[model samples]
Target: MGHGVVLAGLCAALLIIATLAMGCGAMPIRAEDVLGALLRWIGAHPAQGDDAIVLSLRLPRVLMAALAGAGLACSGAVMQGMFRNPLVEPGLIGVSAGSALGAISVIVLGGAASVGWLGSFGVTAAAFAGGLLTTALVYMLGRRRADIATLLLAGVAINAIAMAGIGVLTYMASERQLRDLSLWTLGSLGGTDWRRLLAAAPWIVLSLAWLPLHARALNALLLGEREAGLLGYRTRPLQRRLIALTALATGAAVASCGVIGFVGLLVPHAIRLAWGPDHRLLLPASALGGAILLIGADTVARTMVAPAELPIGILTALLGGPFFLWLLLRARDGGVRA
Candidate 1:
């Protein structure tokens, strides 16, 4: 399919899915009602009752999911392109684990602020910081060897350390903190609101804006390091910038919504299969595809059991795990690299 057609399709799917998600949940507002509520709020009409519920509660979480999804998908796309490995993803570098550890630390030691907006912002900040720290550590370690294998090994080491830290924090947590940590680690959009959106959206947006600017660099890098150097791109500096931007995006995502997996790994691979591995189109398409997927998964997660909600991370993993195995089998059977 042409990039235009695919992008338009993704945009349409995102709209349809977002509208559908808006009408889902215990209240189950009609689609028309959801549209009307949106129009009414847009038109400066005072929202009350159902309108308030849709405008205030449903909308923010949906937007949060979209932003987080887009960030992760973009991060994954770039990671795969830079590493020249379809299996590579942002979390491979320990951003998610580091973010989780940071948030867990705050939850266990910081008291009941997780329930408040200010405290929520603190957790987001700490998570962002932790993610950056870990990514930087991995990047520096990898830079010493200056090869993809070294970088990946560095990432593995960092991932293990972050996870171990998370485990220690989890073990030390009080019951309430433990419960909170469990939910956060598992991931959800359930706690999002306007304020939380304010806290997390900018980092995702910044990453979204920043990563695509390097599309040409990524395309060059994928042509092999020697070729890219012959083309005048300083590969080491390019890698540094990519890692930094990816950490920002992935950190914000993990911080805001906890450790939602697979969107990063899954969306880019799917995009590559559907549209070919052109980073220019791959970057934006992955963003839209990611939004569609997470919104759809989140809708299923929230409405699956009505009064009770499933963690979206679980849903994505459940879906991505089987798909990953199939991918592995395909590779083993001599399938082409994306």
Candidate 2:
């Protein structure tokens, strides 16, 4: 309870700070103006002149970052527990690549975001389908008559294929499409709006709700497949459901915010260090931690370079890469199991 309170407080504090920071700088708006704009937005009073900067642009980006962070982090925690491997994540298992492929295909070939509702849905549908397809393929190929190692290897192969396809798509794309593709690959939470948030929130909430129910199943599966089967937990069914849910959450997140990485991987690792390997607590803690970290990263990305923003993905890699290596080294020295 104490730990939970601390985490909740941290999350709230970081969110408020990020929200305020987002409104300031770049456009160089005053704090009073930002406060006035917020008051107006809440039906207090209308701000005169252009309120687009705060109301239309930055607010949505911050909200999207929060949602994306939660989605990805929760997805990562689920994957790690399902696979019984801390190293596994959406990016590692090909979900992000698959989602990217689908979205990119829509932009490059389906006239995405330009052709009204048909085109908009086309991109999202393509992304979801691509993500599911990739997960299915990985599951099929990874199983050596239903073996997890085989599934993992197959996922690696599929990830490679999807990445190669991305390269080809990049080469063949038009100038504008290529630019959009490049930006998406780098990842960002800019340009979000209430409509976009509404479209994404349900999926995020649905995915998050699965964590508590699957906590015991993940714990059982961690004891090994044969043991889990003998222990009367249908391993395969749970695994399938986990993979499906992960694909849904991760695909939606990538589609909405591009391919933001590390939040999933990094948050789970940090939570484990704090609370140990109890998925029940790990899930929510990691979710909050991920939201706070990504919000901070996004804040840094937007502010560090002033008007020109750095990609959120770049910021995570710059920070997470070295940190991941250090984790690996410590894990090796301590001889920790997956």
Task: Write model 1 residue lDDT over 152-271, tens digit each, in one string.
Answer: 577678778878888888888878777677666789988778988888898889989989899988999888778999999999888888888888888778877888877888999998
In model 2, the runs with Cα more than 4 Å from the true position are: 1-3, 28-36, 43-45, 48-51, 139-156, 226-232
Local distance difference test scores for all models:
0.83, 0.75
Model 1: ten consecutive residues of lowest lDDT: 139-148
Model 1, TM vs. native: 0.91
lDDT tens string, model 2, 1-338?
A: 46667567767776576666666656777667776777788995766654768778777777778778887888888877766667666776688889888888888876575665556456667777887787676655544344444545666787788888888888888887876786568888766677666666677778788766888777777787788888889888888888777777777778778887778888898888777788877877777777778778888888899788889999988877786677667657764454
Which pairs clash in the backbone of model 1? none
Off by over 4 Å in 1: 110-118, 137-158, 336-338
- Prediction 1 global C-alpha lDDT: 0.83
